[model samples]
Target: MSWLRPQDVVEKALAASTADAQVTYVVESSEANLRWAGNSLTTNGSMRSRQVVVISFVDGGAGMATGTVARTGSPDVAELVAASEQAARDAGPAEDAVPLVAEPPPGAGEWDADAAETSIGVFTDVAPALAEAFGEARGREELLFGYAEHAMATTYLGTSTGLRLRHDQPAGRVELNGKSADMSRSVWAGVGTRDFADVSVADLAGEVARKLAWSRRRVELPAARYETLLPPSAISDLMIYAYWTMEARDADEGRNVYAKAGGGNRVGERLAALPLTLRSDPFAPGLEACPFQVVGGSSGSASVFDNGMATPAVDWISGGVLTNLIRPRAWALNTTAPATAAVDNLLLESPGATATQDEMVAATERGLLLTTLWYIREVDPQTLLLTGLTRDGVFLVEGGEVTGAVNNFRFNESPVDLLGRITEAGRTERTLPREWSDWFTRAAMPTVRVPDFNMSSVSPAS
Candidate 1:
């Protein structure tokens, strides 16, 4: 693939723009992937791509208007700039318009550095470990299927206001599924990582093996409320959904669950009975993300006018109480609140939580254990009701032991409401959300127990 320095491209675009104000962003990315099925490696490859976007701001006498144009790979700086300016000229004034961010963050000094890259070598450790695990699975007449992916992206942001910044981000994930010889039973295990070094194929394989063994006996039970233990992966899925809807404007307008009865958002209201805290930090260890805003559009939670704005750590929910919401500079100005940029990573934790998932399972007398959740969709906006089906594996725990696997069930619950019902929360750890993996994968969560988790109906899914 043809290559151009992302930082240089950002500067060229900024210089080419004729609008009153302009912001240019370039993302140079590299990726590597490995897939295995039927206890053997099926595919392996690497790829490279770049995203170039130019946002132009114009003041058409009445007010400010913004336009955005994006292209893959190398984009002609002049054409991209002209197209963006034309779009701004054709549009009406924008309500979210604000001054372009001018202050340089800590990483801005590294703007001249080349983009970081990833290659097939990212799987050096993963490949051999997968091979050994596949052999073991084959000897046991089991089938192993899964994929491992790694990516590195360097983002460069430049603005007419004299801000130049760059960030290098690396992300990786691995998922493994084990099925019995006849495909009668299946189980899943997944891990989120910054690199493959910390991942252990043996540990993941062992978890899959144990779950499949528990499925040797099947139990059929009607759908009803039951004490349920949701693992970290499941918890991440629910919490991420809640995080995505944290637009301050939506709640203040009484359009979502965080809205107060009369007016304003529930900034001080407690959503969970336990003193849990849900936060996002760009500098979070092992889950670090870009520390500033880079945008080509405007939304309730963000604005193109605020491109290159510094993103500080924020606690949306602190000590169980709503603490903050995603508020761009424009929205913050409107609401008379401090601007809060949304970070890409999320973490949910509580004080004094130290029990592992196994310990939580061992302490349970009678409850359901969920392996994963899928097909999740929103049912209601006001109450934040979400519906989804359990998949891969669900087990019945009796007398502090897993007795047998149970039938899958469709569940209807609200992440907001579910928080208030949490009876126990285990230690926080990195996890992979099976449902939202395609869009969101950076999360750290804990296993949680709900005494009466609602199983809306019995699902025939296998």
Candidate 2:
């Protein structure tokens, strides 16, 4: 029915399924965006959508099999369920199959609530501030370009095992780019927030202005290993990539970087000397996410059978030691490890790291400050080697201060290996990863100082 709510959609899908087991979920999302270029607003709009996912299980002899079908907007409930069941019968036994999650854990989310939503009104306070920033940029003979977006997705999950769980996740990001009138010098600043309330347009504009001012005197530096300071946004991109590779099965099978030299994963080995802790929490203040598992397809890090499973606080790396990896229940049964679902939000911090990025800059005798990392690609799975390019703003720090902007360079390094060489981690702050923001946006990280960061080559990219 056109009038069906998101919760009704989930309930209808579950009721229509005739398989041995079933799990149904509906994600109702609302998004609002603001885009600007050349110091002028280009467009602003809002949209709403609904997505339905139905997973059906069948017992056709050897073992249980599962199949999933996902559809955008309001789908025909009975037909979708039938499709899922038929898909299950057409496939072979699922290796990751297990009994569905029957009970809710401590933070399984609400059972009855309206779907959270967002509208263009979320940017009510931001528009005027952005206009002011535009005026300031115009007077400075600079151009501003960027986008701001906020979205709220409410998930309604239901299972045949008698569980109904829901979670509302709000994700927002604002990126501001400033360039000189000639477009030769450019810099970027971005922030991540659950709501626009915490984002400060003036502060972001000031940061961009300062970077652009520093770029007035440009210098060329050859590709070489140098002391580097990676800001929180840049660090988040690297750390998030590392976090995505934390699969128990891959490491245990000697397939990835976390694998030990012998035959097992490095679950307890010290990976760094600086006592860094990389963790995820479903309820991390401004970065809160879904408290329970919600997946339409099964993979190395997630399983369709694990729906409604609670995602608690997990310390992937604690005090420089590898603590745990994502282990679904099906894989946990084989490894003798507890099922640890992955949370959507991640944070990396070190105790007593009170220095800000400016403070770290003041302490540096000579180094490079990276604003963003883009075009990242994996080079080697064995050692987690990654290659990417520095973009927008690359500043030269000399004698405990930022002297001027430098040339962009291609970089080669691995987050796992780089962890060991970290000399300092500035205070953790919520920031947006420019490369991975499309997929992973909720992250808090610290500006990290590396003694000898590898700059593979000077890039011609302006």
Candidate 3:
């Protein structure tokens, strides 16, 4: 079906609206899939049978809820409305309760966004290509593994705020893993919705081969500080999570690191030295997302901007300073909320460099080239001191070349500290997968040269 009309039913429910009536409609459909070792492991597809409707009465302080049937089938709108009213009545009067602002009817095409439909064949055909690519490699490894997962969601939302929106999104992931000596080594994770056919198995196999070969030189860099480089994947994860803890509300309550005195939020603070800026453009070619949001404990789509205004581009960071902080619309209206920032998709920007990773290594004079980080944990929220293991590939770079692979190390460092210490950032920013939600984040990061990075402990898992 090109368009599933949940708004029509929502309007029907609204026609019987009373002076105290408040209503919201949300409809969603999703497809989820998983593949492993070039084989299908699980597939799940569902058109949400229950369309969620919530009605609240401000004067009576009563709320109710109900679930609807399938998209084309009869929906129990009345039951949902009654439930909402009952819910509101059940909750005793609250001094803080406010009436919901009524929204007008939506305009044409307000709830539509273009999206490509996907299917099982996407995984079925790509599985063998992945299997064949990894199988062709001749290595001493006992096992080889890989996985790809794709998910698509479509949400339609309408509210009394004269707001209406529909959003469609497709997210996907792919990764390679291999075991040789005695470790469960992992390759890079591919994130984003680039075509499945575009994943080069041969190229992927080569990366696996390099990691397998690095297994031979397992030397440890003794406990101390040294120059280091962080790939995009690690960078993205660090930044995304760091900001999460730095939320204004958390800061306001002394729950976060950047909280300021006198109920003021932190902005225009210089946090890092390495030139970095992050922004979200839903229309950005590779990173567009569904712009609307659902109300808290409510489903479907709310307007993009919190105050019924148009959605604004979000800047998580700019020139190494805290520029934008995400705040809810209500908060924005009452207070100077830093823009309400979610763990939104991040894009890294850097200038074209004069040299390559090889040249950077050659220029390093002496340093550690870290391929990936793992088992990350937070030690201090205030300082952002994070602990994690160096895994799969850790190499020692000397006089512009990888001298040898090094043993894994337990290290503690802050993203702010690391970015500040960067002496040389490669000209090219590479898009890499993040550790959390490995499927969605595409970190535009470059090889950074940092001096005096602390490598705290040694580990056998090289």
Candidate 4:
């Protein structure tokens, strides 16, 4: 049987919602997914249910009830509706419910691509291939790791003011890992997309193969700030997190480094140098996600932004000056909705003029190339101070060439400071996961060369 459409579900839920009394909003969502992993082709599948109903009673109060199912029957539905109405009543009065925008203009289609159109079996097969490749690599012991997730979710929303909207997202990720000679070090890679066709396990295996081969040599890296190159994958993770942690709430509380005095906020402040422009674009090719707010449930869908806000496509540290801060809905309302707040996902745009890996090395003069970051954590929320270990691969480059794999080092650095020191960037691209979306990032980055990279300390064991 075809699953319940958002509109149909909304109609049924609304029938139950308005039965007893005042009901401001009723929203519901549902999801189903299939995933696979390992050398074995066992398919992993799951189905999830969610609903959240926001109510406003005549007594000037509001309430909400959220759960995996909408209702069992008449009394259950009555109880839920009553509970929601009472909760709204109990919260006392806030603001009059603002009129949500009218339903979006008709669209050609939902993002639900044909399920039969793709298969993750190839992605499933990649794990063993990576393990096999690692096994073949001389002086390297293959350490196999695997992961895959295929997910789908639907949103059905209804508000008393004639607002109705529905949307859903289907997406997934697949990955593998391999280790080296002493097993003290290793390499990692993964692929992800809304459709399984894009998740090539073989390609993932090949990437691990490169890491296995490239990380053969071990050298000691000297402690000092030096020019460094970052691949695209790593670049994506750092930039994305930089935005997530820079919340307006954090800034207001003076927890963010970019916080300003007198509660005016810091939107256009000069934070970083030129060349770092971070923005969010939901329309970017191959990366479009649902532009609806489901509030962590499987029901009703509102416009992607929690409140009446548009998604931002441009973010800036133009010419290396701090430019924008992502603002969430509640914060936006408190601040009168500045354009600096973003509902879209983050994207760090790099110019086309960046040097290629070879060009970056040629211009390096001397530096280090960091493959991946590990155990990254916050030191100071205000300044973006972070501490993490170099992992998977770390190489020393001298006079335009990778000298060899260097023993991983531990360092503390600021995201703001690191981006500011960039002397050169590479042209290549790699897709990395954002902080909100995935377990580990897969960054496609190019070599970068910086001067005076500080190695605050070293690890006896990496």
Q: What is each predicted model's overall lDDT from 0 to 1? A: 0.91, 0.93, 0.57, 0.53
The digit string of per-residue lDDT tens for model 3 on 27-121 reads: 44444455454222334343333355555554542432222222234546666566666666665553223334444322223554533455665
Question: lDDT: which candidate is best?
Answer: 2
Worst ten-residue run, lDDT, model 4? 296-305
* Deviation (Å) of 307 in candidate 3: 8.6
Model 4 spans with C-alpha error above 4 angstroms: 1-6, 18-79, 92-143, 249-253, 261-263, 296-312, 316-321, 328-341, 428-430, 434-448
Error of 4 at 374 (Å): 2.7
With candidate 3 superimposed using the best TM-score fit, by how many Å does residue 436's alpha carbon deviate from the native? Answer: 0.7
User: How many clashing pairs does model 2 include?
Assistant: 0
Ranking by TM-score: 2, 1, 3, 4
Model 3 residue 346 distance off true place after TM-score fit, in angstroms: 0.7
Clashes of each: 0, 0, 26, 44
Task: Assess candidate 4 and give its TM-score to the true structure.
Answer: 0.76
Give stretches of model 1 more than 4 Å off. 1-3, 107-109
**TM-score between model 3 and native:** 0.79
TM-score, every prediction: 0.98, 0.99, 0.79, 0.76
What is the C-alpha local distance difference test score of candidate 4? Answer: 0.53
Model 3 segments beyond 4 Å from truth? 1-27, 32-34, 38-81, 84-116, 139-142, 181-189, 252-254, 261-263, 297-310, 337-343, 352-359, 427-432, 438-442, 460-462
**Where does candidate 2 stray beyond 4 Å?**
none
